[model samples]
Target: MIRSYEKTDLEEMVRIWYEASVIAHFFIPASFWASQKSTMKEKYLPLAENFIFEEEGQISGFISLVGEHVCALFIAPEMQGRGIGRALLEHAKTLKGKLSLKVYKENERAFHFYKKCGFVAASEEVDEYTGCVQILMEWEQVR
Candidate 1:
């Protein structure tokens, strides 16, 4: 089941973000993700619209959006490949007529996933946050 995020889900969401980011973005030091936990919990998350996927009463994954941008999407490392990420992304598309997101260029799994979901690479640029080459991708519903 997917639903809007509640304040109580914040901790689990942050944990998923930290763990998933550290593992998925292996090019970045784990310390970077670890250090950003508090920021993700206290600052970034509060500023975005968040949706969580719950299965068997436990949170499995989440997606965060800031305006039309997909700021974050993370599935618990242990719970990946179960369509949770795609579900969360589809939810985002329903809410926003058009969507955009940035993903590290080295994260091929995510890049291909986004492509399969109808997002096209709009550009490539260095991400200011992590100083990594990233792809800016966008998706728009056919009308």
Candidate 2:
């Protein structure tokens, strides 16, 4: 089931973010995600609108949006490829009408996934923190 995030879901959601980030961004050191944990918990997640996918009473994945821009979408590494991310994106589209996001250029899985989900790469820029090129992608609602 998909629903708004509850405060009780914070810990699991943070864990999912950290784990998925480490796995998807293999070029980055695990310590980076570890260091971001507090910010994700104390600042980012709290400031963003979040939705989660729960299955069998456990949290499997989640998506976070700051206005029309999706800042984060992650699935527990073991639970990926099961459509949870697509479901989350679809849900976001229904609410926002159009959506945009940036993905690390090196993360091809995510870049292709977004493309398959109907997003087009709009531009690219370097990420100041990681010095990696990032691709900006956008999806517009079909009329």
What is the TM-score of each predicted model, taking all chains together? 0.97, 0.98
lDDT (Cα, 0-100) at 98 in candidate 1: 99
Q: How does candidate 2 fare on TM-score?
A: 0.98
Task: For candidate 1, report its TM-score.
Answer: 0.97
**On residues 30-106, what C-alpha lDDT tens digit does candidate 2 reach at each position?**
99889999999989998999999999999999999999999999999999999999999999999998999999999
lDDT of each: 0.95, 0.96
Best candidate according to lDDT: 2
Per TM-score, the best of the predicted structures is: 2
How does residue 8 of candidate 2 score in lDDT? Answer: 88
Clashing residue pairs in candidate 1 are none
User: What is the lDDT, from 0 to 100, of the residue 95 in candidate 2?
Assistant: 96
Question: In candidate 2, how many Å is residue 93 off?
Answer: 0.7
Model 1 — which ten-residue stretch has the worst lDDT?
A: 122-131
